[model samples]
Target: MNTVEAPIDIATEEQSIEVKTDNSAENESTNDTSNLDKTEPVPIDVPENPEKIEIARLSSIITNQTNEISDLNARLAACQQHYETLLNRQKEENSREKQSTVMRYAQAEKAKLDSDKRCEALATKNNDLLKEKDNLQVKLSEFKLMNTKLQNAYEHKLSELVALKKELEKTKEINQSIDASLKSTLNHLKGESSHLKEQRESNERLKRDLNEQHELNEQLKLQYKQLTEAARAIPTDDEQAQALDTLRNEHNALKGKLTNIQDENKLLREKLKSSDEDRLALENVIENFRQTTMREKETTKKLYDDLLAAREQDSVEISRLKQIESLSNQTLADNADLRQLLEKEHQLLELTQKLTEKNSILQSDYEQLQLLHKGTSTDFECIQKINEEQKSQIAKLENIEKSLRDQLKELDEKYQTVNKLYEQSAKQYDDSLSEIQTLKKKHQANTKDLIKQLQQLQKPKFTNNSNEHGPMLLTSPTKPIANKENSNDNSSSHGSPTGSFSSLNEITSLAVPGSDHIPRHTPAHQQQQQQQQQQQLLLDEEQEVIVNIVDIDRQKLIDKLLKQQKLLVRRNEKIEFLNDHIQLLTQDLQNKRKIIQTYAMNEDSFMYTSTESDSIKQQLANKNRNNSSSLMATLYNRATTTVNHTTNKLFEQSSPMTLETALDVMGKLQSVLEDTLLKNITLKENVDTLNKKMPIVKSASTMSESTTNEAREALDCLHELSQLLNTGLDKKTLTACVRLLEAGVHPDALAQIVQVLRSETRTTKL
Candidate 1:
C-alpha cells in the first residue's frame, strides 16, 4: 500500500503540472509563475519492502525520466525564450523597416517635388520660348514689312529725286530764260539810264547858258544906268534926249532878251529835276538786282548741303538694315538651340518618371519581404508550439492526449491564418506592381504620341523679341467627380490608353469630397481592419506630387491652345484696320483731285477776282511793309514791270472762286465724300463678315501687308504731286501732273511714271 501511494503521489504531482500549464496561459501572473516554480521539486515517499530492488529500479527510472523531462523542459524554455527574442527582434526590425520606408518615401516626395518645380520652371521657360518665338515671328514680319515699306519709300524717294532733278533742270532753264529776259530788260533800262544821263548833261549846259545870259542882262542894265546918267547931265537938247531914248530902248531890248533867257533856264531846271529822279530810280533798280542774286546763291548752297546729308542718311539706314538682318539670323540660331534644349528637358522628364516608378517598385518589394518574414516566423512559432505540445503529451500520454490534439488543431489554425495573411499581402503587392508597369507603359506611349503631335503642330513665329507678351490664356471651368472616378482619372492622366480625355478629365475630377475609402463607424476589430486596408491603399507623398504635376501639364496644353486662338483673332483685327485705312486714303485722294479740277475750271475768273482784290492787298502790303524784309520790298519798289502790277495783280485773293459756285461744288464734293465713306463702311462690313465666317489668317495677314504697301505707295505719289505743285510748273507740266489722278494709280507708282516722263522731257530738252 505504501509503494502504491508513492507512485500515486508522483502521478498526482505530474497531473498538477499539466493543470498548471493549462491555467498558466490564461493567468500569466508572476505570483502564479513563482508558485509553479516552487512546486518543481516535490518530496516522494520511500518504504523498505521485500521488493526493494524493484522499488529502487522504479525510483531510479522515475528519477532518470524526471531529470530527462527537466532537461527537455529547460531546453524548451530556452527555445521559447529564444523564439520570443526572435519575435521581439523581428518586430523591431519591421518597425525599423517601416520607419526607413517612410523616410525613403519622404525623401522621394521631396525629390519629386523638386523635380516638379524644375519641370514647372522648364514648362514656364518653354512657354516663354514659345512666346518669344511668336514675338520673334511678329517682329520678323514687322521687319519684313518695314523693309518693304522702306524699299517702297526708297523707290519713291528715288523717283522723287529724279523728278526733282528734272524739275531743277527745268527751273534752271526757266531761270536762264528769266535771266535772258532780265538782261534785255536791264539793257532797256540801261538805255533809259543813258538817255537820262544825256538829258541831265543837257540841263546842266542850259543852266550854264542861262547863267551867262543873266550876267549879260546885268551888264546891259549897268550900261543902261550909265546912259541914263549921261542923259540926265547933258539932256536938254533934242540930240541928248534922242541919245537917252536910244539908250533906254537898247536897255529895254536887252532886258527883254534877259527875261527870255530866264524862262529858258527855268525850263532847263524842271527838265534837270526829272533827269535826277530817273537817275535815282535806275540806281535803286541796280541795288535790288544785286541782293536778289545773293539770295539765289544762298538758296543754291543750302539745297546742295541738304542733298549730301540725305545721301549720307540713306547709307546709314542701309547699314542699320544689314545689322538687323544679322540679328535675325542670330535669333534663328538661338531658337534652334532652344528647341534642342527643350528636347533634352523632355528626355530628362521621361527618365525621372522611370526612376520614380522604379523606386515605387523597390518599396513594394521591401513591403513584400516584410510580409514574407512575418509569415515564416509565424509558421515557425506554430511548429514549435506543436513540438512543445507533443513533448508534454508524451510525458502525460495517459492524461493529456486529447488536450494535445486540441492544441495541435489550434496551432494549425494559427499557421493557416499567418499563411493567408502572407498570401494576401503578396497578392496585393503583385497587383500593385502590375498596375505600375502598365501605367508606365501607357504613359510612355502617350508621351511619345504627345511629342510627335507637338512636333507636327509647331509652327514658325514672326518676331525675335523675347519680351513680347503673348495672347491671354484661359483655363477650363472645374467640376466635381466621384471618388472612384477621381482616382481613375489621376492614374489615367498619367497612364491611360486614351490619354486625351483622361488628361482633360483630371482637372475636372481633381477633388472628390466624400470617399468610400474613408472609415465610418468602427468597432475595435473593424477599426483595425480599416487601418490595415488604409495602409494598403495609401499613396506616398511622392506619388501625390506626381499626380499634381501631371494635372498641371494637362492644363498648360489647354492654355496654349487658347493663346493661339487669341493671336489669330488679333491678326484679323489688324488686317481689318489696314483695309479701312487704305479705303480712307483712297477717298481722300479722290476728294483732293476733285478739288484741284474744280479750282482749274474757275482759274480765269479766279485770276480776275484776285486782280480786283490786289488794290486792297497792296494797301495792306504797304501798311505791313515795315514788318516785311526791306530787301524784297525795295526790289518790288524798283521793279520796271509796272504794267504787270497795273494789268493784273499776281497775288491771290481770299475769294479765289465765286461763292455760289464754290458752295455748289463743295456740296457736291461733300456728297461724294459721304458716298465714298458709305462705300468704305459697306466694304468694311463685308470684310468683317468674311473674316467672321472664315478667317484665313495667313491670307489676311498677306492682304494687310499688300494693302499697307499700296497705301505707302499712294502716300509717296501724293507727296511727289504736292512737291511738284509747290514748284511753279508751266501749263504743260501742270497738265501732266494733274493727269496723274486720271487713272487710279498708287502714289509711288504714279511717282515712278511721272519720273520716267520727266526724264524723257529732260532728255529731249537736253
Candidate 2:
C-alpha cells in the first residue's frame, strides 16, 4: 500500500507540477501575445492577497500616464500652430520688405533717368562745340592760306620798290649830265646863259614833286610798322593780320586801312578764346555724366539681383510647403491604418476572454464530482460501495468529460474563428502593404518626375542667381521634420481607446491562468495563437520599418529626380539658349552673306568697268603707237627721199666722181631707211599684239562675272528650297529633316521620302 500510495503521490505531484508549468507557460504566452498585439492590453493573474491590490494600483498609474500623453499631444498641436503663425508673419514681413525694395529701386531708376537725360544734353552740347571747333579750324586754315598769299604780295611789292629806286637814280645821273652841259654852254655864250637858267628852274620844280612822292612812301612805311605792332599784340598772330592787311590794301591804299585790320584781328582772337573755354566746359560735363551713368547702371544691377533672390526664396518656400502637406497626409493615412489594426486586436482579446471563462466553469464541475465520490465511498460495503462510487464517479466524470468536450469544441471553434480572423487580418495587412508599396513606388516615380522638372526649372534660376548675386544662403526648416524618426513604443501604445475600453472586462478575465482547470488544450492553442500574434507583431514592425525605409527611399528618389530634372532643365535651357544663339549667329551669317553678295556684285561691276577701261587704254596706247609709227615712217620716207635727192645732187655736182662712190652713198641711205622702217613695223606689231590680248582679258573677266552670278543664284535657290522645306514640315518632321540634313543629305525631303518608301516596303513584306 505504501508503494502504491507513493506512486499515486508521485503521479499527483508530477501532475500538479505539470499543471503549474502549463499555467505559468500560458501566462508567459499571454504576455508575449499582448506585447505582439500592438493594441490589446496584457491580462494579469489576480491573487487573493495583496498582489491583486498592487495590480489595481498599477492600472491607475497607467491611466495617469495616458492622460499625460494626451496633454502632451495637445501641447504639441499648440506649438505647431504657433510655429505656423510665426511663419505666416515672417512671410508677410518679407513681402512688405520686398515692396519697399521695389519702391527704392523705382526711385533709383528715376534718378538714373535724370542722369541719362543730363548725359544726353551734355553729349549734344559737346557735338555742337565740335562742329564750332571744326568751323573755326576751317576759317583758320583759310586765313593761313590768305596770309601766305599776302606775304608773297608784300615780297613782290618790296622788289618793285627797289626797281623803282634804281630807275630814279639813273634819271638823277642823266639830270646831272644835263646840268654839266648847261654850265659849259653858259661859259661859251653869256647871252644864252639866261635862257638855260629858266630851263634849270623848271627842272628844280620837277625835283620838288619827286621829293613829295618820296614823302608819301615814308608815310606808307610808318603805317606798315604801326600795323605790325598791332598784329603782334593780338592773339590772331601777324600772319592773319598780314592776310587782313592785303585785303585792306586791295580796297584802299596802305594809309587808310591799317587801324581797321588791327581791330578785326583783335575780335577774332577774343572769339577763339571763348570757343576754347566752352569746349573745355563741355568736356568736363561729359566726363561727369559718364561717371554718373556708370554708377546708376551698377545700382540697377544690384536691384535686379535682389529681386531675383527674393523670387527664388519664394519658390523654395512654396516647394517646402507642398512637401510638408504631402508628409502630413501620409501620416494621417498611417494613423487610420493603425487604428483599424488596434480594433481587430481588441476583438480577438474579447474572444480569448470568453474561452477562458468557459474553461473555469469546467474546472469547478470536476472538483465537485471528486468531492461527492469521496463522501459516498465511506457509507457503503466494499464491493457495493465500490460499484456505487464507481457508477457515480463514472457518471460525474462522464458529465465532466462531456462538459470538457463541449468546452473543447467551443475553444476549438473560437480558436478557428480567431485563427481565421488573424489570417484574414494578415491577408488584409499584406494586401495593404502591397498596395502601399505600389502606391509608394508610383509616388516615388511621380515625385522623381516632379523633382526632375522642378530641378530643371530651378537650375537656371540658381545658376542665374549665383551669377547675378554671387553666393547665396539657403535654409530649409522642413528637412529636420521630414527626417525625424518615429518612436516604436509610442506607436504601439497609441491604440484605439474606444476598442480597449469595450474589451476591458475580457482583459481582466484572461489575467487568471489557472481559474479554469480544463485539459491543456487552451494553453496549447493559446501558445499557437501567441506565436501567431508574435509573428503578426513582427510583421507589423517590419512593415513599419519598411514604410520608413520606403519613405526615405522615396525622399531620396525625389531628391535624385529633382536633381536630374534640374540638370535636364538646365540642359534644356542651355540648348534653347544655344539654339537662340545659333539663330542669332545664323542671322549674322546671313547678313554677312548679304554683305558678301553685295561686295561681290560691286566687285564684279567694278571689274567689268575696269576691263572696259583697260580696253579703252589699250586702244589709246594702240592709237598712240600707230601715230608714232606713222610719224616715224613718214620721217623715215622723207629722210629716204631727201637722202636720195642729196645723193642725186651729189652725183650731178660731181659727175666726174667714180660710179662706185655714188652707188655706195645710195646704198647706205637705203639701208638706213630700211632699219628705220623695220623699227616702226616692230612697234606696230607690239601694239597689235597688246590689243589682241585686251579682248581675251575682257572675255575672261566677263566669264568670271557670269560664274559669280551663277553661284549667287545657286545660293538663293538653296535658301528658297530650305524655306519651302521648313514651311512644309511640322515640328517632328522638321526635327527629322534637320537630323537628315545634318547627316549630309542634300535634300532632307528626298531622304524622308526614301525612308517612307522603305518603311512601306517592310510593312508590305510583313
Worst 10 residues of 1 by lDDT: 469-478
| Among all candidates shown, the one with the greatest lDDT | 1
The 10 consecutive residues of candidate 2 with the worst lDDT sum are: 468-477
lDDT measured at residue 28 in model 1 versus the true structure, 0 to 100: 42
Q: Per model, how many backbone clashes are there?
A: 13, 8
**Pairing residues by index, what is the TM-score of model 2?**
0.14
Q: Which stretches of candidate 2 lie over 4 Å from their true place?
A: 1-527, 553-569, 605-766
RMSD, one per candidate, in order: 56.8, 67.1
lDDT by candidate, in order shown: 0.53, 0.49
